[model samples]
Target: MHEVASQLSADLLGSGGLDRDSGLRPGAARQEVAQRFASVVADIASGAVQFPLPGSGGTSQRFAALRAVAQRDLCLARLVEGHVDATAILAELQEPSPGPTERWGVWAAEPPGEGVTATRTEAGWRLEGLKQYCSGAHSCSRALITATAEDGRRLFAVRTDGPGCEPVPGTWQAIGMAGSDSPDVRITDLPAVPVGGVEAYIRRPGFQHGGIGVAACWYGGALAVTEPLRSAAQRRPDPHTDAHLGAVDMQLHAAGALLDRAAAEIDQDPHDNSGSARLRSLRVRAFIEEVCSATLCHVSRATGAGPLCRDLRHARNVADLSVYIRQHHAEHNLAELGGLVARPENTR
Candidate 1:
């Protein structure tokens, strides 16, 4: 899978596919990025690429693949990560795997707004209302979405091409990660298959592992953004530029080491028998988020605005990373981590 990511990155660069001047508009880029992601999904579906399942003892390899893709293009990585995560979720729930060539996404974002609601029907479950941040809205043939039920939150598997499923246009409007194609989707009476019991999605151990996977993508984006600074220091060898490079190197080194440790921990305790998965994820994600933020600052300060103004790829990377890392939930997640640590037993 890691090799596949490297090959995909090479293909994109060789074709000049992700360059802004590659004759693709923002909307066009969104479509193209989805296509790129689908092709990789096909690779995974086939025996061509073996995407490691979370907690399969190859968690580090899985994260490395995610990081590799993200290093090339964050938008593409976002879609790919969702697809893989959907597969992992299905496995953890003992659900049937998706058919080969079927593109999947996990849409469970619940902001302070109306979200999709599930009503139990004689035939099955029906979903209605609006789902925000539906990434791969235009591309995914299937999705594992969360909806509010009378009892509580539940996970549902719905075919995106089914009736009553509509992707609202003009809903996603951001320069950064625009190619992710995340928009508000409105569903009206869409039939869905319940994946697991209420709250099962979040309660599962893989949930924390998946969070670390996202941080891997962010770490990769940091690496991509750090390139400009690295190149500048190499060319001019200025003391200030070199200093920034050293700082970035140290931050990245720490982040990578933490990811390695987290992956190993997940492999050792796939079921979270130690009850520390959440804590591990919280610590790793928060640390990586800070590393990514600091990297952006250092790289920007060292390279100045020349790359942002002149290089389309670098500009897109910076913008996409800025938006992508926001998924960390800032202080809200930190507070949760704090609460967890404040436990009397946890402190010891």
Candidate 2:
């Protein structure tokens, strides 16, 4: 609701767009993104950045803000993912932390090799091994990481810039989402503070709600890709172009409406307290993913390769949205939904 966030979004979408070089190099882009995003967060207390989550608005409003941010720049949107998730996790655990100046990432991506394990030490809990998909490793000062402890899976917060913390650059090779800087990190006995007990991270109500928030970002990306086709259709009355535009319009509209519905559901039943959060999230994310895929297809087909071949921002939006929506687990997620739907209580 505040003008600061809207101004920032506008600035990002304007002349602030990245050049081809910065677009390709993630490390270079991450630092600027980190600083800008941290500024946005810091301005919250100053009545600048109006994040709807913990403020006057509810869950539904949060998605609106997320969608707006993601539509402007996908990399900028990536900045919000870890920070908000970590904040929620810490708040749920009721752990004290430094001021809002600190940025955080949630590193739950299971490492391909050895899992980061925690061992009890006189100082506190210490983490060992590697954590993959550590986005914002360079930018984020602190992180909430999931690791294997002696008892079971658990969550811990650690200082990424502290001793024994090492970010393994050149680990992420993908062209898309490269600006996200989601690289692997080698934690050689990094000191950690346990945020919650074993299984607490997974069992938290915010986990499912967080999944739905991601869908809002996907919806925004999908909507962004359709803009070119919208203009194309308006210029010429080609039935084929109009047909695709109509489809894209309908798809994006449905996606937006669906996001609104998901938000309303979340706000009415905060933290999935109704035991329906999982099913609701599964349906919302899967449907949004489907919309994103369809929008990408229809938009590309309608506008042809002109945008992808020429426009950097549009091309990046297409590329980034393609990768971001892949966070959708597809068949596995569908199977989980099917099982949930088959439950007698869910049926009722």
Candidate 3:
């Protein structure tokens, strides 16, 4: 399944099928892209395009296909000079049966000031507050912000450009995923649309799946880091170095399996909230952290600091993977796993 998905992704890349300049009508292009996306989603639903890790087996390809779809849409959006909020799209895909009247927003950040209210106005909602750590802010047409209201109801889904809503430049100076452009945005009396009901955003399956997806991305990053090392090891093997490479390989495989199990559980029961699913995600992330840490350490030890030359891909991989693994839930996730295991039920 991964081979087929890889072929499709390769074809999309090779033929430039997703290119926005293909002269295809906007509607046609949208349809085509949507079709491909649907295909990918179907593959995911059917266990055809398994995520976590796509080895050459029945488990199917995992994170690579999902990332390919995401990258494809992002590139297409860039070419068309239009943007789609990937977080929102993922949420919608995960929750297809959301109520229409219930607006849905994804605002997870610390409020800047106090008593800032988000109100509904004639044109749109008036949002006055500051939103920080907006991951896809620059590229999203609309933002689901969390702001206080005069009545003290925390409001979400303030427009990005309506009225006084402003996108203050994001302060994201991270080493990895610099392209994510997560910045702090300021909204002052901005006109906005309300998303789903209060707390609706948190209740969706996508919210949990998004965490898994993040793990998947890290999994991909680990692979990206390991691939070069694997190639190098194969090309030139030393007995001492072979031992280190074997250890790295074992860690990578274990991490991949954990991610795959998490994906399966999430897909099978989107609303489980079971310790098992949470444990799976937590475990996957932990393993990924270990895998990346070990792989980088082994690479550095095996190859020495000479590979730190700016031109070396290994150096960049090391840097990127190192930074990427520290995303929102690294230590917290590990801690959560610890808590879960400490529970009486888990002890059994």
Candidate 1 yields a Cα-based lDDT of 0.89
Whole-model Cα lDDT of every candidate shown, in order: 0.89, 0.78, 0.51
Candidate 2's C-alpha runs over 4 A off are 1-8, 12-16, 54-57
* Lowest summed lDDT window (length 10), candidate 2: 1-10
In candidate 2, what are the lDDT values of residues 1-348, reduced to their tens digit?
112235455653444345666766766666666766676567543545555553223666677777777777676677675677677667767887435778888899883687799999998888999888888877788889999989998898889887788888678877777677788889997888888788999887778888887888898778778888988888888999999988888878887788777777767777566899889889999999998999999988888889999888788889889998988999999999999999999996
Candidate with better lDDT, 2 vs 3: 2
Candidate 2 RMSD to the real structure: 2.3
Q: What is the C-alpha local distance difference test score of candidate 3?
A: 0.51
- Candidate scoring better on lDDT of 1 and 3: 1
- Model 3: number of clashes? 10
RMSD to true structure for each model, in Å: 1.7, 2.3, 8.2
Which residue pairs collide in model 3, if any? 50-61, 50-62, 51-62, 102-196, 103-195, 103-196, 104-195, 104-196, 125-192, 170-183
Q: What TM-score goes with each of the models?
A: 0.96, 0.93, 0.68
| Model 3 worst lDDT window (10 residues) | 75-84
Clashes per model (N, Cα, C within 3 A)? 0, 0, 10
